[model samples]
Target: MTDTQAVQTPDNVAPVLVVDFGAQYAQLIARRVREARIYSEVIPHSATVDEIKAKNPAALILSGGPASVYAEDAPSIDPALMDLGVPVFGICYGYQCMAAALGGEVANTGGREFGRTPLRVTETDSVLLAGQPAEQPVWMSHNDAVQRAPEGFTVTASTEGAPVAAFENLERQMAGVQYHPEVIHTPHGQQVLTHFLYDIAGLEPTWTAANIAETLIDQVREQVGENGLAICGLSGGVDSAVAAALVQRAIGDRLTCVFVDHGLLRAGEREQVQNDFVAATGARLVTVDAAETFLTELKGVSDPETKRKIIGREFIRSFEGAVSEVLGDRAASGQKVDYLVQGTLYPDVVESGGGTGTANIKSHHNVGGLPEDLEFELVEPLRLLFKDEVRAVGRELGLPEEIVGRQPFPGPGLAIRIVGSVDAERLATLRKADLIAREELSSAGLDSTIWQCPVVLLADVRSVGVQGDGRTYGHPIVLRPVSSEDAMTADWTRVPYDVLEKISTRITNEVAEVNRVVLDVTSKPPGTIEWE
Candidate 1:
């Protein structure tokens, strides 16, 4: 409940625990749960039975993984979990584990049903598959199959690879599916999850945007007290803008939104924040010109984490200094700014190792890169919400779509977009190339089709190219376009060939320092959306 990344909501927030089996999809499952207006968290499979029981969860979900249930080192669950009397739903690998744990027959099968598979419902009136198609397609990725149902459970669906594709026990309020119902590839993923939560788990949908905004405002009011002053780092991105708006709502006129222009932002971003944001939110604004300081601190730094850490430290320092700008004649009143508001999302928290068993993917400036001598207490209202959920809350607060629907941008800015050293020359070059790309994408009407497309400047790597009928060596622009429900998981977007060609052509023709443009087709698992 303090200034941490923990999920703090109203006292009525129902806690749903997701048992992660060491897969990236675990977080995706948690997001889906939140999409249904329910609160969920991912706990590692290594959690002890007592540790899980201590949470006194409203319900439990088991996530899918790559390992077989019978493998020697494969992760296993405590059999006692099934007897906890909570409605449990399992997917893919989780389904197999629960089957094996409950004395069901699991066979090696020597066959794998991956990607999309046809599922035949053997029981149309089944609890889990209720009202679902008799024969439909479901996403499957598993080597082992459940051959028999656990006692008191009815086998409802079957696939060519997994005969026991779906099963449920209405009396026990437990169910599972051999195929994954959490992925978008499954046509009825969300509907299936909704059925489980509303019918089987008997949970109420109380996590609406209105409820979320009201609860967060009340919590911020309690934390800041009567006379406390807060300063939010107002980056141009939607996350920071919404966070600033949310905090301003909690304590009107007392919250100062400080925007530090680090000079690494894309074109027109400064104007967007300086004019559009203030016109929309009407919050007290202070602009700090720290571009030279950021560029100097990052002059010889090429490591992504180092740049992020440096930026994070400088951001706090800037916020601390801006305290005086908003104080004015009240400086002698002795009221100090002690709170720093941020829009740290849930994906940032998981990617920064805030969640159990999640790898430290990268150091997000606000989450993992905060300096040891931080001066202000952190108040991250959107820290527990996903990207989509944050947008919904922004709309609920009556924020303009221009600020709320803006693409996701890193807190460290264009410094991270450049793959090499940080300097003015590289920053200017990347900014030009990035502008062209953004302009092209918008013109092609593909802005909403894919998520943010990062135009990276490979400062350290140059390629030979011919321009203006002469040979020249210049940097190559890497275009990374990905599609996703949330930033937690992403797949490379297959933009039309014409759009790609136009983007590449415009960048090469407009950017003088470079000659080539390249498209990155790697997805989230193997490569992150951002190059660094």
Candidate 2:
């Protein structure tokens, strides 16, 4: 059956299933699966064979984790799943799991391999290595190695340190690889993954943003049928904007977008949301000016989590008020709005323990902190997509580059950037400094080179400096420039001296209240992109 037919068959039918073993790259694996144009979902490794079988997956992928196969509490695969008829591919610790569960031995070799490694395919007849060269560079990160293959499995490839680097069981259509093919460190990772998905598993590479849009439109039509109006919350970010546009395409005039200007946004942000979004999608929009409400709630709050909670509570009230206004107008015409759409993405779901049922990290307002007693059914169109894929879909739906390619902005806005309490004066000072930094970065043609350059203001701290041959005390603003593949982990970008000089000069000269401009040289592990 075709992919669409497979999805339509039942909830049990997914083209691919990724078994997440608490790996940081588990989310990346899901992304790769969708890249292959086949629907995939993440389930915990603790899931039983019957549970996996109920999903009716065409193939199974085991994700790599930090744990060693020799650990006492290491994750294991179900023997029943191995006996199942579906094709299976194991990666890293997953390969060891397969070996240990199938009468093979895994031993810690006292030698750990990390990062990029080379593998040699001794046997080219194996289906997994059919089109690949005899020797290729692959990524490896493991402390244990499989000493032997299970009954019917044969070694297909090996590295200098690893003997069972690659193995296959053609009769069962099962394979395992010690290296990580999902990471970019491996040169031909995607190519290898595509080979298995298309050649070995026989999946079609028909997945594209256009196909996703079309399928979702049909599903939305069936779910809402006729005469059901949907309300969308537009954050002016790419996710929300794209979600709004897609829903508009699905139901046309029946969709209403609510844009909240929380007074906490950067310079020109509100106007961009008001003019650019409406011009691009032609959807009916209700712009709510809740700047006063946000500022009022954030009067004396300084703690980051406290500020987040207060702002979140106020936002919900403001949005509910907007929804009520829409309903009040619709009530005059005897129409009822039944859905509330959000721009939640796949990472949000995965981070919320869609796989392992772990506690979610409470960093954002939208993830799992929504009020449970709401009245409208949730509509998350972008829940199955990544950030880049969302951008692609936005382009396919004809959204403006300003709306589609805009960098990610936190919902808390400047409140989080200011280390202490927030007010009009502090926010204005930060905005001015931030604008200078952004202007200089764009002028240097480095906008796309960095993920985001957050200009932070130390509102409570002041530094001594000389201006016009006099001692002056003013707050210092910090420039945080980071480079990232996904927002999960990031590294500080080494900005050129010329670019830094230009930014520093502009911020110090134009912004009168600021005396100094400092650069943040910390990475994501020790410090997040934002100070708060």
**RMSD (CA, Å), each prediction:** 2.1, 3.8
Which candidate gets the maximum TM-score versus the true structure? 1
- lDDT for model 2, on a 0 to 1 scale? 0.79
On lDDT, the leading prediction is: 1
Instruction: Pull out the clashing pairs in model 2.
Output: 12-55, 37-207
Q: Write the per-residue lDDT of candidate 2 for residues 1-532, one digit (tens) a residue.
A: 1122112322323558788787877667767777777777667787788877877888999888878876778777777788788988888888888878788878887766888888898887877877788889999988888878888898989987788898888777778898998877887777777777877777876657887777666666666667788888888888889988878887888888988788888998888888988999888889899988889889888887778777766666677787767776678887777887778776655544443443354445555445556666667777667777788889998888988888888767888999889998899999988888888899998888998888899998999988888888999999999997656567899999999999998888888888898999998655767887
Question: For candidate 2, what is the TM-score?
Answer: 0.91
Model 1 steric clash pairs:
none
Clashes of 2: 2
* Local distance difference test values of all predictions, in order: 0.86, 0.79
Q: How far is candidate 2 from the true structure (C-alpha RMSD, Å)?
A: 3.8
Candidate 2 deviant stretches above 4 angstroms: 1-13, 131-133, 333-335, 352-359, 460-462, 489-491, 521-528
